[model samples]
Target: MAQVLEFKLPDLGEGLTEAEIVRWLVAVGDVVAVDQPVVEVETAKAMVEVPCPYGGVVTARYGEEGTELPVGAPLLTVAVGGTGGPGPAPAVEQGAGAAAEPTGTAASAESAVSSEYSGNVLVGYGTAGPAARRRRVRQTAPAATPAPVAAPAPAPAPTRQGPVPVISPLVRKLARDGGLDLRRVRGSGPEGLILRADVELALATARDHREPAPAPVAPAPSVAPAGERVPLRGVRGAVADKLSRSRTEIPDATCWVDADATELMAARAAMNAAGGPKISLLALLARICVHALARFPELNSTVDTAAREIVRLPDVHLGFAAQTPRGLVVPVVKDAGRRTAESLTEEFGRLTEAARQSALTPADLTGGTFTLNNYGVFGVDGSTPIINHPEAAMLGVGRIIPKPWVHRGELAARQVVQLSLTFDHRVCDGGTAGGFLRYVADCVEQPAVLLRTV
Candidate 1:
């Protein structure tokens, strides 16, 4: 007898609850091996492939591309131990909700449920690793058949049964808000799972779409050209929420000072000339920030308002701001206080590349004690930036442009930069904040000042 098993979306970790379907790797009636990637999903953090736990012919899939499913939602069902597919499937040893992941043997998947690589594919649906690619087994598409003119069969009516087959709260909320009965809409997802799209489809068919009818307007002369509008979602939405919370909860103050970075630039040139790995200018600035934080540790701490106490972090998880196609992101470097300038430079390079390619993991994007925003990349001179919430402070660097300065009583062209510090006023006074910013400026003007503490 053919046994079917349902696999729900597993925890992708880092407190993520839902993911949007990006692409499907296998189709219905396709033979999928255990731990093989079936769909690519985009979480708020990153894009990952959700591997199937069951090895058998794919019976059904739940969501379409761009449909978001919550964690523990059924992704698909597999007909295990069925004779209809290409090869023999492993016997169903586990009951429903047990591991549907890869069994070891390809020859007898119906019998084998254990594998050496099982650790990589955690319980329900973990991340897929680089496994040996098995030959793709797929049913031919019906579109290729001749005379494809028949109307599609009518969808079966949804049953009010023991389980609703609905998983996402967002989906349920939509149906409730729209006053649509969940039992009326036919689910298009695998195994009759109701999806947001299914509810939406029902709404459009039965009731008004809630979109207002266009208002009558007389044609008018065109004025100035309009600008573009980008939807705030994904990374952009996360940024907006965090910054808004910071503004609402935090009493932050900004202090800025101009620094002569000519010596800092010269020191960087010297280091690169004799270097094994060229040190980045940002790394040097980061090194200065780390050392300054050591002296004014108050700026490196956050206020726990509930407890009414300041929590001072022991080590610095340094976050540097990098702009990507997705918008601005801050990738944190762990234990930055213990790293050398060379190491910091290498880490910055790796994280920056990952950000540009949109390959940063959730771990790479969080847990920062402080942030270094080199807004100078955008060719700006200064900015009063909102702090990354819960973190005590942020350091913003402006463009290092050449300007006339007095060097040893002589006016000379020198590289100068403006540094701004935004700190939570609840944690520290103006004196402590000014001391931290002044120390950073001193390091830029005299690179040797950093060596005295080192």
Candidate 2:
């Protein structure tokens, strides 16, 4: 006898309750080895390849790809034991299969499968306690209709959309942001799992094949059309939720100061000039931030509203905002206060690359004590950006450009930048916040000032 066992989705940790099926790695009648990845799914945080712990032949899949299922929903059913045919399709004996089929109102077929699973717990979730026997729910006899009805019961309406198979979350996000239907894109990966390259190629091909709107044949009174709708989901949704929380919960204030960055930029150029492994500009700024935080530790702390206490953090887990094709993400550099400029530069490089590839793990995104946002890359002078919630403060750096300023007791064109500090008013008053921003500005004006604490 062959036992048909059902496998449910496991808790993927990090408090995620559900995941969207990204791709199916196995199909019906396929032979699966224990611990082999059966499906790839996308949660709110990252894309994960989920491995099946049961070794068997797949009998049926519960949900289609792109289906959002709860943590405990049935993922697939497998038929194990009993070998008959050479391949997986004929694994079950013909006699067992015939006896199990539900023919009429009389015969019922079933068997219990053992609960023991391979000790492979991917995504940090595993079955607990002793294995238990599982039995199929019995179906009641169909009630007789008033007339001579012979057809089977009608199916209910579908609430969700059909499935689309794709492996990369980045690909899905791209299609979502561009308002493109993922089902229309062709997959190029194994078993037709869509890759990032496939999406990009499809987009390029679409653009190349598209023609102008015929200029309306004749410009008919150009009228304003309705705006396009964009649903906030995935990375963009996460950002929106956090920003809304920060705005609603925290009483935050912003303070800005213009700093002379000539000395700092010159010092950076000099370091690179004589260097083996040159330090990055962001690294130099980060080093200054650590020294500034050391002097004013209040800004490095977070407010424990529940405990009604201000929790001052000891180690600075620095987070830098990196913009990727998916969206803006902040990858943390752990124990940044203890790292040198060279080390910080190396870590920043590694994390930025991971962010670009959308390969950042959950650990890389959390545990950020402070955020350093260099919005200057967008060529902006300054912005009063919202603070990253739970974290008490964020330092925003603007573009450093040549501007006329009073230097050396005379008017001169100096490379200057605007630095803004947004802090939770509950954590610190204007005095502490202003002092921290002033120290940072002083470091920019005189790079030598940092040597005292460096």
Candidate 3:
């Protein structure tokens, strides 16, 4: 008897209802093993590779690359038992084909089929077969008196091996760019073959001793030739869609406030002096925003343009608008509500590094309840920022400037920073938005407010 199995899209993360199919690694009739990568998906934040949970021959593909699929929708089908006919029909038809009957009853079928095979399995899709139910039994027959077995000679000691081999072209290029010796890297790819990830790991390990490369010289500007055109795809296309949707659908309002952050900067400098990573002013500001959002959960929300509903999140996930060479990329930190300031600083460092290298996955880019964009690094004072939709608000931090202020009736120079909050007016009114900004400004002006809340 032949058995068929359907593989549905697994839940990627919180509040993620759907994803775009970026690529498929297998085709019909291709044999696949459990835990082998079968497809790559692009979620709102990053691209992720999903593995097959069953070992079988692929029977059908449910959707094409670039098609958006909802969670729990069948992605592919596989035929087990070697002789099994094509598996269940895909939920979405790509072409004309005879429809297969819906397999056994949902409750009993999954239970009966899943109770069979015993192996390390992926979540949701359990193993199937008689081996899953078999138990080891002890041998009870008396052993015959053994004939004299030949004495085995002592095994030779293994020789010490050098670094693993490099085989990937991408890894080789990365190693060359980083001025690394491929021979010195222990590869992590299949059969010890070096990959781009391994080369990156090697570079990270030797970062302390490696000298930073000089910045690249900019190309000289020239007059446009007769006709020049460039097709927009991939990141460019995604960015244009997101920007247009945010601009048209979300009714945004902006407010600016100034803070004397002399204390916060001093505190950060003191912490760095004690051998900690250099925490930036923007990072401190992010921490404050997260703290304020926790107090006013309404601020950390998204307006559903299609549903005409405001969805408020229980936890805070801070998204940072990182300017990348390709374009603007917003990668979010998951559960900012649960992390400490120090941990947030480390996450910021990791996120920025991943963004710059274009290494962020889709999961890292989605599910943001709030966002922060720092123009301070570029020496900009302040400007109105467009809210990153789904997320009701985005806070912008501007450069710190020395300004005269009255301290106990005496004129004194203080480091002042401009902060702008852009919020979705559809969900938040002026009063709510203003209060949120005022709370954040208070926290920045007096770092002790954070301690009091804790």
Give the best candidate by lDDT: 1
Off-target runs (Cα >4 Å) in candidate 3 are 1-227, 275-278
* lDDT scores in order: 0.75, 0.71, 0.67
Candidate 1 pairs with clashing backbones = 53-100, 53-101, 54-100, 61-190, 89-109, 89-110, 90-109, 90-110, 91-110, 91-111
Error of 2 at 314 (Å): 1.7
- Highest TM-score model number: 1
Error in Å for residue 404 of model 2? 2.6
**Model 3 steric clash pairs:** 45-362, 45-365, 45-366, 46-361, 46-362, 47-362, 116-129, 117-128, 117-129
Point out the worst 10-residue segment of candidate 3 by lDDT.
141-150
What would the per-residue lDDT of candidate 3 be over residues 167-212, giving only the tens digit for each residue? Answer: 3344567788988877666543323444454566667657734567
Cα distance off (Å), candidate 3, residue 405:
2.9
CA error at residue 208 for candidate 1, angstroms? 6.7
lDDT of 2: 0.71
TM-scores of all predicted structures = 0.73, 0.66, 0.53
Local accuracy of candidate 1 as per-residue lDDT tens digits, 1-454? 7666666676666666678787777876678777787887767665556666677776556667766677666677677774455543333332222224423442244223223213322233323332322344455422111111122225435557666777667778989998887876666444556666677777765554356776899988889678996555667767888889999999999999998999999999999999599999999999999999999999888888899999999999999888887678899999999999999999999989878765677778878999999999899999998899889999999999999988899999999899999999999999999999999999999999998888
